[model samples]
Target: MIPGIIWRVLLIAIALVFAGVQLDREAGKTYPLAASVPEQFRSASQFPMAAMALDSDNPDYTLAEAERLIRRRPLPAEHLRILAQAQFAAGATDESALTIQYAAQRGWREPLAQETMARLAIDAGDMPEAARRYAALFLRRDTQDALLEELGPMVLSEPGGAGRQTLIEIVGGGDRWHNQFLRRGARVMPADAFVEIVSATVANGSRYDCDLLNQLERGLTTRDEAAGEGLKTVIADQCPS
Candidate 1:
């Protein structure tokens, strides 16, 4: 019912609005998601670790907003994690995994991504994948040690007993992580895993197996020895040479 001139004017106005939106969207397709985040997150000094928490009652909505803004501009590693986590909480786990994979493919070197992948694998009931991902993270030079502790619960998902399976996986790396596992991880492990490690180490004939018992003599003499006693007798009696 409008006049032709008015109709033309309205169409032009709508076209201009659409063009503006397109421009905004193109601008946002890399860090500094200024459109979606507050000033603090945009700041170089406060972003990443110090940015605002994305915790929300409607995590799914939050994820959509993040994805929209990220399409306009890529957010930092921390922000990407928030996005992926929201996807996970919203039960969009497959999407969350792909989001993390995209970040990794984009060369994100943060351990948080790796840890998140492992957790996601756990949620999906993929325990061996979880273990493998955790192991990869552990071997990283700057890997967060807390990730190993976090592995405790996920390890419970492993078959052949969580403790034993985790220890087997850890020790399987031989020279690369064997001693590291013994010194940094073995003692505090679940009692069953410790027992399994000790048992395997004493029975090893390689004399250089990944198991910590291969070097039992040194262990028993340490002033700050591990708390487990089962390996003490095995080392003294079996590998006395």
Candidate 2:
């Protein structure tokens, strides 16, 4: 004879599982409505639509979706970041700033939030803040080359020699990005800036790699003869026989 309590528990579990499946089906049907339907008509299942909303060009749709997701799970840093970006794009500057503050507090290591704050810092002429953010981004393999393309010159031109000094510290410490930075710089950076960074790295007590210097010299020479001559002199000065 089956006990009543055991049968009740078994039935409840099966019911809950079926309910979850039903909810998922309903959410799937609602997902396509995210693009065309007004916010009020959207499904209660907001999570399914989050990705589509975030990718949309309309900030209003993104803002609504982010707000809904945040209400459901208030601590997700990604949701907060999307909310912050939507607010910023929608011209709600103060709201955006406050939301990013929350996002940062929740997930300081979140890359999207970091990039948002970094761009805001750049817009505000806060070079040191921008440099700090960019230095963090430089450590990310996927972002390094793109960042160098966009912000390398700005960092190279940082006033009072602080920027160059920062470069020296990174390369001098033999950070893995050191060689990649130099190799990529040979293509993206002004030849003068590239030469100065390499020269400073060697002068700062890091052992010079003659082969790397030779490669850099050849690359710069291919781009600009005068710059190549300049790097040749630096190579002679920094890498002795």
Candidate 3:
């Protein structure tokens, strides 16, 4: 007859081996894609549902899985983003909005979260908030030019000027993106509005190089000669006499 302690040891070993085999099987199912291994493994280790959270086609399932993952220690921003995205897709607008804010609070550096925030703000008719979110995105070199191109016209046409001014005040703080914004504004904005923004930036101690001025002049010139001359006059007057 086997000793009770020896039998207990054998049973414990079997249970551990079974658990290991199960874990290995789960890992295989979760990690077929090499690219997702590094990021997804960390989440999967803490919450077994991470695989479904990331891979599920149904937004409702993804949302539920992400919520489960987030309940573990050190809430993952990526999971929060997944939750927010899934919520948005599932027509849970109010919940998605709140979840995205939680994600953004975790880190504003994520482009998708910032974009989602901006879209939500736009849907809420909050242009300033939208511009603020885009401005944060504009700070990223990869996204700056494309966003400037995409949003320049909208800013130029912003009614009440509040949204435009908000962008100017933020982007005008000597970030490299503002130069392109001004150049694009010169072509797309009404001459008066372009001049006013330039004058305002100058008043706030921002200086444009001759190249930028020359580019704006050329862009305005190709669009309208009278407007170009009027812009040149404004530039000259705004400069030290």
Model-by-model lDDT, in order? Answer: 0.56, 0.69, 0.65
The reply for model 2, stretches above 4 Å from the true place, is: 1-48, 56-61, 71-77, 89-91, 98-115, 144-147, 158-160
In candidate 2, how many clashes are counted? Answer: 0
RMSD values, in order shown: 10.4, 5.7, 6.5
**Clash statistics: count for each candidate:** 6, 0, 0
Worst 10 residues of 2 by lDDT: 34-43
Better model by TM-score: candidate 1 vs candidate 2: 2
Model 1 global lDDT (CA atoms, 0 to 1): 0.56
lDDT of 2: 0.69
TM-scores, all candidates, are 0.47, 0.67, 0.61
> lDDT by residue for model 1 over 42-80, one digit each (tens)?
333223212233555776566666664465357666556
Which candidate comes out best when scored by lDDT? 2
Which tens-of-lDDT digit does each residue in 17-82 have in candidate 2? 666656655765777644444344444455557656767899888887778877866777767887
**How do the candidates rank by TM-score, highest first?**
2, 3, 1
Best by TM-score: 2
Better of 2 and 3 by TM-score: 2
Top-down lDDT ranking: 2, 3, 1
What would the per-residue lDDT of candidate 3 be over residues 55-89, giving only the tens digit for each residue? 66787777666665676534666667777777877
